[model samples]
Target: MEYKIYVQNLKCGGCAKTITNKLNGIKGVSNLNIYVEDSLVILNCTEIILEKVKETLKKAGYPEDGEQNSLSSKAKSYVSCAIGNIG
Candidate 1:
């Protein structure tokens, strides 16, 4: 199955990298694609694995579609981007 998740605070390549790293860690995810401009994450996986992906994204500071991002959340994304760039 394929899932499309719109993640808030997904602003740059750094955010995409972070999301990719975390999601790739999951056992069943495959064909993962992160669209930074659209804030969309596309992937192939089972329904059960889909929930795990959503939870993982939320924990990683990129909440799934429908969730509002706070100012702090946006700030955190920038910080994450900076760290990702450095490392």
Candidate 2:
């Protein structure tokens, strides 16, 4: 199945690569797409890996598009924090 996730903080191709790699690591995920301009991520995977995808992103320095900032401008900054250490 395909799941559309609101993932903010994808600043550049490097950031997108990080997200893609992390999400693709999940066993249930077949593909991943990130839209930096729209601040969204489309995940192609099974329900079984939904939580895993979130966790992976969390660990990768990008939340599922909603967090402390909650704004497009601050998304990348927050994502950097999340990726840096989550501290």
Candidate 3:
């Protein structure tokens, strides 16, 4: 099954990489794709683990679709972007 989720605070390549790395660690997750411009994440996984995926993303600072981005998250994205550029 495929899951489409829009996340907030996804500002640049670093944010995308962080999200991709975290989600890829989850069981049953496969073919993960991050669309930075759209703040969207696409993944193939079992429906049974959908909530787990969402929870994992939330923990990683990228909340699920419809969740507003907090000030801290915005700041984090900026820092992430800088760090991404440095590496």
Best by TM-score: 1
lDDT of each: 0.86, 0.67, 0.80
Pull out the clashing pairs in model 3.
none
**Could you tell me how far off, in angstroms, the CA of residue 65 lies in candidate 3 after the best superposition?**
2.6
For each candidate in turn, the TM-score is: 0.87, 0.69, 0.81
* Model 3 C-alpha RMSD to native: 1.9
Model 2 residue 63 CA deviation (Å) reads 0.6
Over the stretch 57-84, how does candidate 2's per-residue lDDT look in tens digits? Answer: 6556566755543454355545554553
State the lDDT of candidate 1 residue by residue for 1-87, as single tens digits: 988999898888888888888889999999999999999999999999999999888777788878766676677778777776666
> What does the lDDT come to for candidate 1?
0.86
- Model 2 alpha-carbon drift over 4 Å, by segment: 68-87
- Rank order (by TM-score, best first): 1, 3, 2
> Lowest summed lDDT over 10 consecutive residues: which window, candidate 1?
68-77
Please give the lDDT score for candidate 2: 0.67
Q: Please report, as a residue range, the 10-residue window in candidate 3 with the lowest summed lDDT.
A: 76-85
Query: Which segments of candidate 3 are over 4 A away from where they belong?
Result: 79-87
Clashes of 1: 0
Model 2: number of backbone collisions: 2
Cα shift from native, residue 38, model 2 (Å): 1.1
Clashes of each: 0, 2, 0
